[model samples]
Target: MDMSWPHQSQPLPRRRALAAATGLAAGILLPTRTSRAAASGPTQASALNAAASYANPVIWQDFADIDVIRVGTTYYASASTMHYSPGAPVLRSYDLVNWEIAGHSVPVLDFGAKYDLNGARGYVRGIWASSLAYRPSNRTFYWLGQIDFARTYVYTATAVEGPWNRLTTISTPYYDAGLLVDSDDTLYVAYGNTTISVAQLSPDGRSQVRTQQVFTAPPSVGTLEGSRFYKINGQYYIFLTRPANGQYILKSSGGPFGPYTMRQVLLDLRGPIPGGGVPHQGGLVQTPSGAWYYMAFVDAYPGGRMPVLAPVSWSPDGWPVVQLVNGTWGSSYPSPAVPVPPRPVTPMTGVDTFDGTTLKPRWEWNHNPDNTKWSVGNGLTLRTATVTNDLYWARDTLTHRVQGPTSTATVQLDHSAMRDGDRAGLALLRDSSAWIGLERDGGVTRVVMVDGLTMDGNWNTTGTGTEVASAPVSGGRVWLRATADIRPGAARPGTFSYSTDGTTFTRLGPVFSMGNDWRFFMGYRFALFNHATQALGGAVRITRFELSVP
Candidate 1:
């Protein structure tokens, strides 16, 4: 299977038409991420630290299904979280080059039992491509997305640092939608697959007023979705993604829904990551100086899709053009020139001490957790929630985005409290996963490394696969390390090791090959899991957690 897009030529992105964080302990800054550009790549690509320019995959991590909005000088972006609790992450940026966690739109995925991973049933389902909009008239932010393609969930808050409220659930499904709060305070949504449609929402945006199909793609542009709506200077534009790879724009001067005109904006665009695909789907934002920039994501799996920014230039006739160098999207560009640039933000990568009452915004539960089973003070504790051999069904498996091109994650676990048949440790999680952890059986505890556990279409998985490596561990204190090379060019290793004294470490088990199939949209992640295959009541305490991207 070819994960890297190799057939990108012209008529790329629609030129051929047709379709298409926060909180907790002191900061532990990540070492500068490695940046390697093509030999003939831009001169500044290697100077990622320069203040004047920034590299593509601007913020490298799993910030998939993105929609970015700028409020005054501050830029706020939203991304999809399928099963992770505290879904719809809100990211804040000052200079567009740097971003930090602001908050989340949904405190928990409460629409149904599936979202709670009940029975491990919600595997690859929950929130999909969401549309985020802000209503300046009310100083409120709105987020809309469909769940399981069954119903659209709407949430709203006065600020991005939110105590967001679930406004309503629409029976209407807005698949991969874009939300627009017109100047008159009226709401409009553009959504659908190859055939895009616009719908008018009640002023409160709690209910749909009406719906209309505006445009349908030609047969050539296959699989079009991901709608990002905006009303620019009285013209409405919907930016969409056309895969295997491309981004197209639909413009209408008439109204929110119109007989729209189409153009291709991005196609087969490549970034610094050698095999990474082009950037697309993100909306456009303009700086105070009237400079336009497009923020989009490139498919850099097994680490997941990442956001990239490129400049936008309006053509002589009012069409928007994606700025490119050497006939393709380059690896570096001049950063968005914002007026009164906000102060630099601390990067999201770091060490976390779970001393605070609230989990840092960056940490998300694998699903809507059984909140009663977890707590944080000096150490993060996870009580066994399910007596299942499958970690997929276990609630409260905390997850963090794995950094790219390469990064290492380490966690200290105190397993003294673990009951028999409990597994607790760090993992590189996806549909197929591998983990190094402590497993207790009949009172004997052993550090084990397991791999090749995968789920079927129904989300069933092998409960406790045979361990590849195991060692009897006497002490209750253990440290697990996971290092993954998610460099985008080809498959790489996601290796695991264990430490007893926090100083010396020994690699264990065969290296797990990271999978890069794009169909699993969430990509690979670093997960902290504790689940039971026997009786409940077993638990583990995470004393220290650090993710180093260097």
Candidate 2:
């Protein structure tokens, strides 16, 4: 039986007494049932196990470079955009478990002239990693990040989700700007590369007024950056992770523009640099309850780097240290006091039988989509309007955002007639640089692969298998499925299978593996595309898209 509850998905109304009563009833009710069940044996948390796991990413998906901050009663978390369009969409939570989109600070990014960020797949056109800082002196929330040619810039507002102020360009070559506001309300920023520098921001919080000064970095720490400053125990502390190593902590008597001294290597990866691996950037924050915590990005598998959080302790000498036992962070921690239910590990569920009234949030646009290419009313139909290779349909093709590996997506395609140059296919596209698609040529369908901006022949050079067959679409209803089984340190493998009806499927035998984590920055995306060709028959229709993971 398919469980489709549209009413259950809507947000509840706000009422003080009613909410209080509901909370009290929920607190008394659920645990009682769970306790009774526990007496039998260890029981399932809820009916929606996949949703619970997806909700708590630490328990399921691989989350990376997490920057989190508490604003008012809400906690907002944002991660590094591996390279998709609208940059990184910030996820918001009241406690940390139940999360929602908190609105993007960098909504409209101008990469430069000519190359609009609209799906131009190259180096860094969209938002990269960003730092979220709350400045009370001006009552402003600041988002600092790096875009393609624009370099490092800061967008400030009084709200977390904002009609943000214009970009405050910091002319420095620093990549990631870690923002901090001291006890005296002095604003400061830190960046790492060949040199680590700390500078004081002007009172308006728009520009840096003080001279940039060098901060303490161990002679052994090579090109370490992503530095952040926090005051603890009457001493200002600098917490930074070596991009090529583990994390380090330093202390200074002065403020951000400080004569700081290196304290200790809080956490260290085994072996030397360059060839030897180290965990990437991380974020550190103190909870309201006075517990010190550290959250860092870890690449557990070669191509599967995500975020993990660990607790930190202060040594007798006032140096901070990360606790690790057999060489891994603790697996579980208590959720915040606010009762956010654990989410299912799998998010996109059920058959998205596209009767076409609403478009799912799981579907994403390439860079920024043009509103004209798609319409939803009956079955969701994508109209091929633009022909220019430089147009919006080409630039902002429909794609899926990267969640994690071990997931599957199935979409129903209807392509009876297609133009000669115009092609429609189910594509697993990382960017224009790397993509693999199942395309139909004449009466035959072939699986093709592209690596770093260049498309190979019918087969992949890196051992990806291939298959050719007669075009499967005879009457209408054609189902294509893509499954990704990604292991972190190794190559992520994906397969494309097809079926005439929705039931049984035949393996097309096209296998492709994206490189391991830390080697390149990219996101996994699934898109149904129809490119314009001179041939008159190049148009396709999508009835529905269903995605699930086992």
Best model number under lDDT:
1
Worst 10 residues of 2 by lDDT: 24-33
Per-residue lDDT over 294-380 for candidate 1, one digit per residue giving the tens place of the 0 to 100 score? 888888888898888877777656667777755667566655544433344556677998988989988988888888888999889
TM-scores of all models? 0.89, 0.73
| True-structure RMSD for candidate 1 | 10.6
Q: Scored by CA lDDT, what does every candidate get?
A: 0.79, 0.52
Model 1, global lDDT: 0.79
Candidate 2 runs further than 4 Å off: 1-63, 97-101, 113-121, 124-126, 136-140, 148-150, 157-167, 266-280, 300-304, 333-394, 414-420, 431-470, 489-491, 533-543
User: Measured by TM-score, how close is model 2 to the native structure?
Assistant: 0.73
